[model samples]
Target chain A: MANLSALMLARDLKLLLEERSKAVAYTSSQTHSSLAKGLGILGFHPSQIRKVTCDDSMRIGTALLRSAIEQDKALGKTPFLIVGKAGTTNTSTVDLFIELAAIAREQNLWLHADGAYGASALLCQSRRAILCGIELCDCLSWDAHKWLFQTYGCGMVLVRHRQFLTESFGTTAEYTQDAAETGESLPNFWSYGPELTRPARAMKLWFSFQLLGLNTIDIAINRGFELAETAQSSLEGLKDWEILSPAQMGIILFPFHPHVPAANLDEVNMRISQSAIENNLAATLTTRVRGVLVLRIYSIHPNLSDDEMLAIINGLDQLAHLYLSRASKDDII
Target chain B: MANLSALMLARDLKLLLEERSKAVAYTSSQTHSSLAKGLGILGFHPSQIRKVTCDDSMRIGTALLRSAIEQDKALGKTPFLIVGKAGTTNTSTVDLFIELAAIAREQNLWLHADGAYGASALLCQSRRAILCGIELCDCLSWDAHKWLFQTYGCGMVLVRHRQFLTESFGTTAEYTQDAAETGESLPNFWSYGPELTRPARAMKLWFSFQLLGLNTIDIAINRGFELAETAQSSLEGLKDWEILSPAQMGIILFPFHPHVPAANLDEVNMRISQSAIENNLAATLTTRVRGVLVLRIYSIHPNLSDDEMLAIINGLDQLAHLYLSRASKDDII
Candidate 1:
């Protein structure tokens, strides 16, 4: 559904520009590939997609974006859509939405926030501030299946103006004409997205919200943030462990390196991840941070206790030690 | 899933044309709007989409398609993809796939069969012939949810070459490196479509097939065809009723006209549809045949008894009589 949202916004933006051949879209290189996939689906060529470099926190660089925008304009290219990553997939890093929104306003570009995994954070008072200026976005895509703990098929797209969606996808056939004009009392959802025969995606979100109030959902999200902090503090205490990205919004990116050099650091971290999977220890995976491979954890489960966090650390430490010991033993042989 | 399949194919075809600015796609005007929607999502302009006129049977006219292709080429547009409707939404009209395949082959264009509703008929030996030359198509999109008695979220896409899907959507991020190279033994589905985190849509189909067996599923589909035949025969016998399109592949289109002029026929059909919804009756719908309004019944449910089909006819006939009487009474007053 997040993809649907991006595609919808991109299509409207293109239509709004009247199919400018040189029209381009902008997003952080670290933002989820779904946005790029959606843009590609919406007929934007790979060359037309400008992936602006991100900062150390994996946030889009405002200066770099402005420079790229200016460069594109000088080259007779139209930059119309700018995406802000509210919560990146790699480390749950929230981009500087306020800064991005300001740039978008200055350039008259459509601002979209890909809050697929992080928009639920808005329900939590402590974490909501991370997504400052989110409301200023022209559109936002969020997934209830991700952080809200609902099953799949519950992603949502929010357009500042609802009519934009209807205008984008409101074409109806003879069979669908009645439903389309059923008035505001009956919303023909097919007019809002691509799929015509869609499953009731809103029901799951509605049921969850009804059964567990917003307060309860917020508490669950807050627990994830607490657990990430714990994981970060625990990693810092380890002698061989180095924090690549501090835990924020329920994710941490760290690498384990003892005597391993920078060249072999990626190899060791990869081996540890493989060992974790091989031993069925945990779901710890590896991602690159600033071109360096590192272990990444998504501490999003509300029920994950401190004991589980400790166990995860212990498991990683033991695996790393085993991998190093094995390497040393191979060398001796 | 059907949308993803079409978009993937459309994107690859455009890329194959080396991002030709004048690339165009062809489909019957009677084809599902999803095809056009997918093409639009893939960046094709409304002008690039050539909606070829359909024949009386509502199938795509091949002569018109060939002429359109020539016209587009003459206009410096490269026609890349041509979509054939296996079972159109309105009349269950199966396009002349054999003729379409010949045209696609002669022109070297990618042929995609939008069989979302009718492809399941392939499981029944007696009904498979309706989709003759289906094997010649480059790609096909089918929905298991529609006729296979599976729940929603069960749509399948078949490509002539396995590598095409991977070639279209096989990019990997650092975080996805481990899963991307899981070897030939394990298929990474994310590399085959736009979605990364998709629900296990195949499980429902798998369980249905395992529990009910292919033979039973085939029988269910055949039952729908039988009921459609029964509906066609029944509708033909009714006085003042005209059969717009004969029952084929579990769909029948007809209109009841009792002293009603051609001008208000559309209104009458629409009113019947609205009344069906308001009265909480069967899910009856209306469609257009050669710009004429008609009521369409999809006899897709396997357990739709002969009695039920008769009851639907009776209800529609009674409603038509009531509408005509009310009109005459208003004229007299």
Candidate 2:
């Protein structure tokens, strides 16, 4: 919902400035899929989203993004927005926001950061450097439900300029005139978003902050990084597990290859994931990293102990061996 | 939010059918302002909305709507959706939905009914006739927070064909592939709407219905009509007051104009409303009925007694007399 609002604001800004409805936005293939879906909902064609290639580290390829913008402009498409990821969903890779911010400034585009999964890292001073350039974004969307220890349905969108929200979503009606702003005070919140009668979503976050001091909150966030690193180190000790993406922002990906063909590796990893769930070991899942299907572990629970993480890894290794033996027997048959 | 989703579905349906981005929608001037705001958020220009004038009773003018559609079509605009009000906010006037449904069928347009305030009346067999043609709507947005005795932030949008929702909002990502449907059962709810992670909003409504059976719920809704009629009867006995809109669907509108000029009528009624709030008499507000600023009463509380309703009306009468005398004294000076 936060990303949807940001794209709406960007689209409205382009309409206001260039009076162009055929506007295009730039985001890497590594960015969250919700951004493309939001653009489609906002009346932009699928072709309007330029999925620029990503680097080997899974970060957005900055050169490809620049060239895509230039090409779109040459083709008479208005380039209006650049979406950068503070921490992507799949591999938790942070995009090159500094370079993207420079391009946004040069091209007069809105820079929006999808910080839903990783913005909570900003609470921990030591881990904040990875998202250094996030401050330069025109807007940032953060989800408290992800890493902020909140229940579901809590997300926030922060814009550099407050007026853009009112410009994009301000509403008035005869029944609501009594509650209208008098110009001496802030406008009613209905003007700032799509909802006219929404719950006080910030109250939960406020209560959480008041209950848990910043020091404790920062430690909780830092624990996520510690857990991810523990999972990476434990996986490195395994025989045939190849780390597809190293632990970053509480997410790590790996697959057990064991000199198997590429086609069999996906099947093997998938069966291992299914076995773990079936055996009630861990509720793990598989995701495609680069072109290979890999087991992805998102270990962000502050209460998750290091021993529990190691047990889950070892259990998955055993399941992989069991599944590989079955596959070999089938091949022999 | 429900209306916003309906407009998005309508927009996407238009895109699928005609491949036209310049689609126009029809709604009455008395329709909720949120419709226009939602269209703006969906990238439709303000001019794309044709606010057809309303009749004297505040119902949508059907002839004018037909002419407007014809005019837009002549100008090469794609008319794709028509919004009809089940019960307007100010006067609680329902539009000619039968006429609207017929027109939509003939024009091949999507018909949406804004039943946020009045859909709950469907529980009462006595009041259900007012919303007779609501079932013919391609989609209907109903808010349980109003008229249904639920707390705020409970709304539901029902589409005639469930497939339209999936076509408009179905989304998939690598991280969510494991949860994808295998085509033999129902799809995950994320495919049906913008939210991927939403609270179970239906639980509250379900609980209410379970606790208070349909018969009790029906009586509670019937009390809304009884309370409005009580207020209307009390206002009719008082001097210097005229009913702008009669009691209908739990709403009534009137102005306290005791031979006052048209210019002072708005000022006098507004002051009366303000005094009602200041004196803690009632939280009454004013709305324009046929361009006349009038006191609008939305009385749907089942527990409110007829005596209490009479007392509030008498209290507003006293405040209006006090404000009018003071204004006359100032005029003499």
Candidate 3:
């Protein structure tokens, strides 16, 4: 929802200044799919979104993004926005934000960061450097529910300049004039977002922060990094397991590719994931990286101990061997 | 939020079938401002919405709406939707939904009913007739928080055909495939609305219904009507008061216009409303009816006794007399 609000502001600003109805937005192919869905909601055609290819590390290819913008301009399409990822959902890869900011500045594009899960790393002193250039974004969407330990429905969108938000979402009606700001105080908060009668979503976050001071909260965030690192180190010790993406932002991806036919890797890994859940072990899931399916582990729970992480990884290795043997038996039959 | 979702579905359906990029929608001028705001967020220009004027009783002007649709059609614009009000916010007037449905049928436009407050009337067997033809709406947005006594953020949008909603909001991503349904039962709910990671909003409503049961809920809804009626009758017995709108759907509009100068009516009434708040009498507010500012009362509390309603009205009368006499004394000074 924060991404939606940022795109709304970007759309309104582009229309106001450029007056071009056929505006295009650029984002890395590894970025969350919500960006395209939001742009679709904002009435942009599917073709209006340019999913620029990412490099081998799943970081956005800055050169490709520049070329895409140039190509759009040549095609008479107005390139208005570049959505950078602080931490992408699939691989937890942080985009090259410094380069992205540079391109946005050169192309005169609105820079929005989808920092839903990754922005929470800003709480940790050591991990904060990974999101260094995020401050250069014109807008950033952070979900407190993801890494801040809040429940669902508590996400926030922030803009560099408050005027753009009001310009994009300001509302007036005959029935609500009494509640309008009197100019001596803060503006009516309704102008900041789409909702009019919104719940006090910030209250929960305030309570959490007050109860857990910055020091404890920072430690909890760093624990997420520690958990992911533990999973990566444990998986590196297991034979026939290849790390597809290293642990980053509490997420790691790998596939158990035994010395079997390469074509059977995806199915064998998928069964291992299913076996983990069936045996009541870990709730591991799979996601595509580059084009191959790999098991993805989200180890953000602060309560997950290092021993538990090691057991889950070893259990997955056992499941992979069992599944491979079963496949070989079926071939013999 | 419900209205926004309805408008999104309508926009997508229009784009899919008519393929008219330049589409217009019609709504009564008395409709909630959220309609225009939602349309704006959907990338519709302000001029694309035709706010057809309302009649003296505050119902939609059906003839004017038909003429407006005709004019837009004549200008090569596609008339894609008609938004009717089940209960308008200002005067609590319900629009002519049957006529609107007919016009929508003839014009091949989608009919959406904004029933944020009034749709709850459907629960009362006696009051349900007032919302006749609401069932004919292709889409209806009902807020349980408003009239159903749930807390805020509990609004539901209903569509006659569910496929339209899925087609409008369906999503596919590599990361969420495991959670996708196998088509053996209900579809993944994420496809039905804008939210992906939503709170269980329906749980509260279900608990309310389970504890209170339907009979108690019907009486509570009926009590809202009784409170409004009591306010209206109490105001009628007093002198120098005019009813701009009768009690309907738990709302009444009136102004304490003493034999003072007509030019001072708005100011005097506004002051009377302010004095009500200052004296801790009531929380009466002001709204415009036919360009005249009048005190508006929303008496939806089921616990408000008839005597309390009468006392509140009498207090407003006393405040009005006090303010008017003070104004006369100031003139003498």
Candidate 4:
């Protein structure tokens, strides 16, 4: 929504193309679906939104992005915005922000970092280095609910130039003239977002931070990293399991590769997850990596202990074996 | 945002207009700022949104709306939407929804009811008549947080057709194939709204309704109406005030009009509200009714008693006198 607001202002002021046909936006294949959904809401056609392919690390290739921009220009399309994912949901992969930022500067495209889940990692000194070039981006979105442990719907959008937001959303009317002319009070918050009557979403996070302190938050983030590392090492001991991607931040992707000739490994992996869910074990869902289904685990719960992690892994193994045995025997069918 | 989403769908499908130039939306001058802010976000210029004149009772004059639509058409603009204020935020005034709905039907325009605060009155048998033709609206936006007494940010949008939202927002991708093919389970909520990972806002309302029976909630709504009526009658007994609007869905609007050459009644009305706030009395505010500033009271707290209402009224009367007496004496000014 923030990026859409900026784009609309640019178009309204003739900074970008007045016609929708010439405007284009770039996003990595690993980017969250919300971006595509927002673009659709803003009246962008599927052809106007170009999904750039990611490399093995699931980061948008700078060379490929530059080529796509050149191609769009050659095709008479004006590229305007590039969205870089600070941490993707599927594999929790952080993009090459420094390189992406450089490209955005050279190409004059608005860079918005969709850090709904990963931006909070910047609180931890050990993990802050991973987001090296994030400061160079024009705007960034962060969801405090996901990482700061606040209640739901507490998302924040930060812009490098503060006036851009008000310039995009501000309106004048007799009812609101008093507040607007005061010229001394804080900006009317309604002029900064889509909604006029908004919830006090920041209060919850403010109280939480005041009570828990930043030191505790940093420790919780670091603990998540350590837990994911521990889970990966524990999974390495299981011969029938293949770790498709090692731990990043707090997420790991793996799939079941049993000894038996499983006709479909994707089906086997899905069954493993379904079996775990049916047994009421800790949830481990399946996501796609390069069009292949893999079981993904997000170990971000601060309350999770090593013993609990072991129990969940043991449960998955037992469930996978039971399903494989049933498949091999074919029962009476 | 919901209204904006529906408007965007109408424009995108060419049901409204093929381009932004000829498209226009009609809304009462008393409609909430959020709707106007939303239209602005969706690329509507200030000229594209026409604020039709309202009646003395704060209802949209249906005849005025019809002529406005005709004028826009004559000017080569296509009128597509007519928004009826189910309850204006300032006066809690209900528009002539039945007449507006009929005009929308005849003119082939989409009718949206902004009932964020008053729709919950439907649950009360006695007050439901005020929203006589609410069911005829094409879409309605209700804020559960306002009248349902739930936590903040629990708003709902009801579309006449179920598939319209999905058709507007749904996307096909390899990652979501499994759930897409099932076709028998619950709706993929992500496809129905803009955000992919929205907090479960409905759960709070569900729990509130489950814990508090319908009978109790109805009584609470009725109590709010009674409290406002009592406040209005109590204010009538005072000598230096005028009730601009009677109680409607728990909101009563009035202004201080003392017998003196006050010169600026708007400033006096604002001072009354400011004095109330400074004294730490009930948190009352001032709003405009027909271009005149008036003190508005929303007596929605169910636990407020008759005695407490009397105390608030007495406090206002005394505070108004104190300021007026200070002005009358011309002591040192």
On lDDT, the leading prediction is 3
Give residue A158's lDDT in candidate 4 (0 to 100).
83
lDDT of 3 at B95: 93
Please tell me the TM-score of chain B in candidate 1 relative to the true structure's chain B.
0.94
TM-score of chain B of each: 0.94, 0.95, 0.96, 0.94
Candidate with more favorable, higher lDDT: 3 or 4: 3
Best candidate according to DockQ: 3
Candidate 2 Cα deviation (angstroms), residue A121:
1.1
The per-prediction tally of clashing pairs is 1, 0, 0, 0
lDDT string for model 1 (A33-87, tens) is 7776767666566787888998876788889999999999998888898888878
Candidate 1 pairs with clashing backbones: A41-B41
Candidate DockQ values, in order, are 0.55, 0.66, 0.66, 0.40
Measured by TM-score, how close is model 3 to the native structure? 0.97
Misplaced by over 4 Å in model 2 are: A16-21, A183-186, A326-333, B16-21, B183-185, B326-333
Candidate 2 chain A lDDT trough over 10 residues, lowest sum: A13-22
The local distance difference test score of model 2 is 0.87
Select the stronger candidate by TM-score from 3 and 4. Answer: 3
Clashing pairs in 4: none
What is the overall TM-score of model 2 with all chains considered together? 0.96
Return the candidate ranking by lDDT, descending: 3, 2, 1, 4
DockQ, prediction 4? 0.40
**lDDT tens per residue, model 4, B1-333:** 666766665565445325565688898888777777777666666688888888888788888999999998898888888888888888888888889989988888888898888988888888888888999988888888888898777888888776777887776554455556356368877777666556798999898889988888888888888899999999999998888889889999888898655456787778878899999887778777767888888998889999999899999989888887886687421
Per-residue alpha-carbon lDDT of candidate 3 for residues B138-196, written as tens digits (9 for 90 to 100): 99999999999988889899998878878878888899978976783867777888877
